[model samples]
Target: MGHQTETHVWDEELAPEPRGRTWRPEAGCPVEVALAAVSGRWTTLLLRELMGGPRGFTELRTLFPDLSAKVLSERLRTLRERGLVAVERRRGFPVRTRYELTRAGEALRVLLVELYATGEELLRLTTASETRDERSPGRLEA
Candidate 1:
């Protein structure tokens, strides 16, 4: 993935996504950001499953026990619209469909892995801090 070096132009007139906020790059081009759209509850789970390889809708449903078929369909449609996934028909006696990540989506896998690692480290630190806090005595009010 090529990083934007110079300041790419931004349109102040453009409307934000569902939420009323725009993403301004810290030091790069104002390319359309992908985080907000795919950073929700079941989004990462969906992406993680796709990382193993393309799978059919039924297969996806099986992986996420709690997710309803309706919700899965919605998420997949959203991902497709965002260019994060490609949906194609599978040729068979009975026609079926499958979903797979796009190049940009695959790149996001690396970022997700890094985020997972960071989350684990934070949890460990939090647990340690809690243990220390529990053992330490607090001051009494005068």
Candidate 2:
């Protein structure tokens, strides 16, 4: 005797009403939405690079040599899905594609600049603290 598996069918009458677009952050939480859009490794760096203007895939890959092509492609797709980046393809002897930041993406430039500034400040503070610790009488340099 052969074992039989049962398949379940979804019935509209039994199904719950679709909750439309629940992933969107509530209107009051703009920061949440912004963070959600850029929440991934190298996402900010990709945005920062795009701020300079449109760049080919090869150009972007060269900028971050350590990043694998797969991750970069994924990041670009995510940015596109979020409406932050637009891709343009030029047909020629050698097909060329370039990505440019949309207005929304350009708007993130200021935020990125502020973040860089904050990072610099944090680095300064950390280095100063390390120097102080090294000079303190009770501490031994590692």
Best by lDDT: 2
Quote the positional error of residue 122 for candidate 2 in Å: 0.9
Give lDDT for model 1: 0.78
Candidate with best TM-score: 1
lDDT of 2 by residue, 16-111 (tens): 333322345554455556677678999999998999999999999999999999999999999999899999989995888899999989988887
lDDT of 1 by residue, 1-142 (tens): 9896957454555543323233554322223354554566799899988988999998998899899998899899888887889999979868899999999778778778987999999999999988887787993435
TM-score of each: 0.72, 0.70
lDDT of 2: 0.85
lDDT of each: 0.78, 0.85
Count the clashes in each prediction.
0, 0
After superposition of all CA atoms, the RMSD between model 1 and the true structure is 9.7
| Candidate 1 local Cα displacement, residue 140, angstroms | 7.3
